[model samples]
Target: MLRALSLALATALTVLPEAAFAAELDGRSLSALWALPFAGILLSIALFPLLAAHTWEHHQGKIAALWGLLVLIPMGLIAGPEAALHALAHTAFLEYIPFILLLLALFTVAGGVVVRGNLHGSPVTNTVLLAIGTGLASFIGTTGASMVMIRPVLRANDDRRHNAHVFVFFIFLVSNIGGSLTPLGDPPLFLGFLRGVDFFWTTQHLWPETLFVGGLVLAVFFLLDSIIYRKEGHIRPDPTPDQPVRVTGGINFLLIAVIIGAILMSATVDLGNITLLGIEIERANALRDLIMVAVTFTSLALTPKEHRLENGFSWGPIQEVAKLFAGIFIAIIPVLAMLKAGAEGPFAPLVALVSNPDGSANNAAYFWLTGGLSSFLDNAPTYLVFFELAGGDPQKLMTTGALSLAAISAGAVFMGANSYIGNAPNFMVYAIARDGGVKMPSFFGYMLWSGAVLIPTFLIATFLFFRA
Candidate 1:
């Protein structure tokens, strides 16, 4: 598989037209139909597992790749082979590779650190565990934090009769909203950092909103879990039985630190640019990806096999994520280009939604539009779109347009909880929990969960923090 992929990359690089270097793809000329492949891939992700679980399980990667080709073939016909290959190669090299590497590193490292044992799943215990995971997210990342924490929380509640709600709230706080504080917390925030937003800008400005929204969600989780607990009455005998929790594979934590350090170094240092074909990427960012790949292997090599086995770890979740998001990254190339084109593009009306009649910024529109796209599309790129729309000036945004920036940041990070595919970690968590016998909700069923809990939370947050 690795050799085949490497060969494909080589072929694309070798054949990329020199003419592709002469000009950029013009989004203003592209039709909205260009988005169909992307939308089709999303619908596949949403409907496949629900409608055709067995077939989807076997052929998801193929389905995703087909959607990718559906985009590329037409793109080659419409815009020339150079443009198509450029989009494919560029998205694969710069966007998908780096994005997947980070998720893979976090998932691998977190999986190696096994928390061995169980505790009774009381409302208080679950709440505290969720709180700790929430705090850890901004530092280790939502993916890292989710992988590390989900098992222990699941084990803590495995004995309870009615416990799916626990993981639902887990997704709410730990996977999404918890990632609002720092660039280290989520992909979108990290993108903002790379775009010149201060590493701590979100930390400073978003803390109050993160605090209020996270606190309210935490409170709601506690209350709902309490009610469920009261009704169920905790009568079920402990299945795993409570045991003394002993953490193994402590060395993986050091790898995690290395991961964090590499990311920071990439952001802080300038190591010049490396251009492959017509695409340019930072040497520091490439080095950061190399470090992440190394950390993934280092954790795997050092961690005991028993630790992973005991942790119930498998490669299925991350594999599925990588395949699905490859298609997403490819398919979304045109969609993002159109968005970047602003008023001259087909999405001009959608673009106008973020501005007032007087031509001032609309904070609420920024929040909802960014959040709404983020809920379906990947939040990282959605964040970049709105960030650029809101003037793309980090300094100005941090000051005069602070509220707009805050809304965009909050929306991108927070509303990712709106769907299973909103963030990388959400699907991974769902897969892990489901494999662990939690009877995790289906994709739309999970949306029902988010629509009930998260929508209201976001509504109140808009009223408080993002009002125009």
Candidate 2:
């Protein structure tokens, strides 16, 4: 299946006319049907695992590729070969490759580092662990922190029957809200960095919002967990007795530093560009990706195999992300183009919904609209769409429209906790917890939890922070 998908991509690159450069299709000329494949893929992701678990487990890649082709073929036929080729190359080289490489590097390095001890799963202990994980998320990324920390947290609470909420709150704080403080923490912020937003800009602008939301969420978790702990009684008296915590595979820390440095270097350095298959690839960005790949393999080679084995590290999560996001990137091409068309396109109602009568930018609308879409779609591109909608001038956004940009950034990063599909790490966390014997809530069941908790919290936050 992988070979077949590779062949299709290679054929598109080789045979399609390539001189048009990386150009998007004229979205106003396309009908709304262009979005059906994108919707199809999302539905497959949401429902198939529940409806046809064995088939989805075995042929998910093929399912993803099929939807990608559903868009690519029709798009090429309608838009002409050159534009289709340019779109494919642009999404692949400029967006998908970089995104996947960063995930690969962080997942590989973090997987190598094992936290080999359990602490008592008291309310205070769990809260402290969540806080630590949340803090680390901004530096090493939510995925990295989640991968490194989830196992120990699971181990710590293995004896408790009322601990599913513990992992759910972990998803809320560590996998989502904690990432709002820096570009390195989340893909949306990283995409902003790639688009010329300063690396520290998120840290500076989002600190207050992050603190308020993260602190509130953590407090709520502590209260909920304490109640559950008191009521549930003792389940089995610490199945995996607490031990002195020790961390192994210290070299992966150095590799993580290299990954961050590499990203910073790409953002700060101007290394010109090279044309590859008619796509103008930035040299610095290309170099960053190469370094990321090297770092991934370096961690794999240097870390003791026992460390990874102990962590229950497997390639399944990263592989699933890659295959699924490949389809998503392809299928989203037309949808984004139409969105870029603004009032003239199929998404005109959406554009109007987020705008004022006098045409001035509405900060609250930007926050909720960007966030609402990001709850279902990939947050990075959803962020980019709103960023462009608010005018894609980073300097202008920084100086004059700071709050609007902040709202957009915060919305994309924070509201990703709204659903499992909202952020990449959410599903992985859910899957890991379930596999470890936690009876996790189903898709809608999880949303009921998020709706009950996150919605009211976000309402308060929106009123306090995003109101004009």
Candidate 3:
């Protein structure tokens, strides 16, 4: 499987057109029909598991491949082979590869380090666990923090009958909102960092918003959990009894530190570039990816097999993300191009939605527009699209356009809680919880939870933090 992926990537790189260098399609010339494949992929992700569970579980890869080819074949026919190859190669090399490598590294290393111990799912204990995970998120990335914390939380609450809400709130806080503080906390922020936004920019600007929103959510969760805890008045025997909490596979922590260092090194250092096939790969970023791959393997080599078994670590979640996001990254190219083209493109009216009638930037609109799309789409590229629309100038954005940038960043990071597909870790957390025998909400059911809980909180946040 790995060899096949390598071969496919290699072939695309080798055939990439030299003329395709940093070129975006002329969005004004493209039709809105171009976005259908991307929409199709998103809908398939949202619906197929509900509509055809068995088939989707068995053949998600093929379904994803079909959607990818749907975009590629039509794109090649309309735009020519060179343009198509260039777009595919560019998306694969620059976006999909790096995204997966980071996730892979985090998932592998975090999976090995099982949080071995137990505790009762008391309201205070659960809230404290969540708060710890939330704090870890900004430092390690949400995916990393989610992987490390979800299992222990699940185990801690295994005896509780109403524990589904626990994981739901876990997704709300740890998997999504907690990631708002730093670039490392979420993919959207990380994309901003790569685009010349300073590493500490988000940390400095977003800290207050992160604190306010996260604090409110945590408070609400505590009250809700207390209610749930009291209702279960009869004592039930703990399925996983309390063992003294000691972390196993401690070596993986060193690997995690290495991962963090590699990211920081890549961000701070530029060592020129090497042309592989037609794509120019940065030496620092490439080295970072290499280091991450090494961290993954080193964790696997050193961590005991029993540690993973206890954690219930499986390849299914990562494999699903890998297959599905290949389609998403490919299909989203034209959408992003149109978005980049601004008022001149087919999505002009949609673009207009985020701007005021007098043409000044509306931070509230920026929050909702970036967030509404991000709820269903991958927030990273959605962020890039809006970032480009708002003038792609890191310095200017960090200064005069700070509120607009803040809205975009906050929207992309915070409102990812609106749906399961909004972010990668959301779905992974869902799958893990479901596999562990928690009766997770169905697709629409999950949406209802988010709609009731998250949407109101977000509206309040927009008024408080993002209003112009």
Full candidate order by TM-score, most accurate first: 2, 3, 1
**Runs of candidate 2 exceeding 4 Å displacement:** 1-24, 232-235
TM-score of 3: 0.89
Using all chains and alpha carbons, the TM-scores for the candidates as numbered come to 0.86, 0.90, 0.89
Residues 1-468, candidate 1, lDDT per residue (tens digit)?
Answer: 534543443344433333422255556666666677777887787677668989999999998997787767655654567877777778777767877788788778877877778877889999999999999899778987897789899888887888888888898899999999987789888767766788778999999999999999999999999998899964667778768988788898788789878977887999999988678989998999999899999989999988878767789878987898888777777677667677877778877898898988889999999999889777876787788678767889999999999999999999999988788788878888888889888778889988888899889999998886
Model 1 stretches with alpha carbons more than 4 Å out: 1-22, 194-196, 231-234, 376-381, 384-400, 431-449
Instruction: List the global CA lDDT of all models.
Output: 0.82, 0.84, 0.83
Which regions in candidate 3 have their CA more than 4 angstroms from the true location? 1-23, 434-439
Worst 10 residues of 1 by lDDT: 13-22
Flag clash pairs in model 2. Answer: none
lDDT, candidate 2, 280-387, per-residue tens: 989999999999999999998999999989878899888998998899889888777767677887778877877789986788899998889778777876797788
- 1-468 per-residue lDDT for model 3 (tens digits): 534543453344433333332356766666676677777887887778668989998998888887787767655654467767888887777778877888788789878877878878899999999999999888777887898898889888888888898998899899999998877789888778767888788889999889988998899999999998999897578888668998788898898789878878988898999976577888998899899899889989999999989777889778987998888788788787767678887788876778888988889989998999889877886798789788778999999999999999999998898888888789889988998889999878988988888888889998898888
Selected candidate, larger TM-score, 1 vs 3: 3
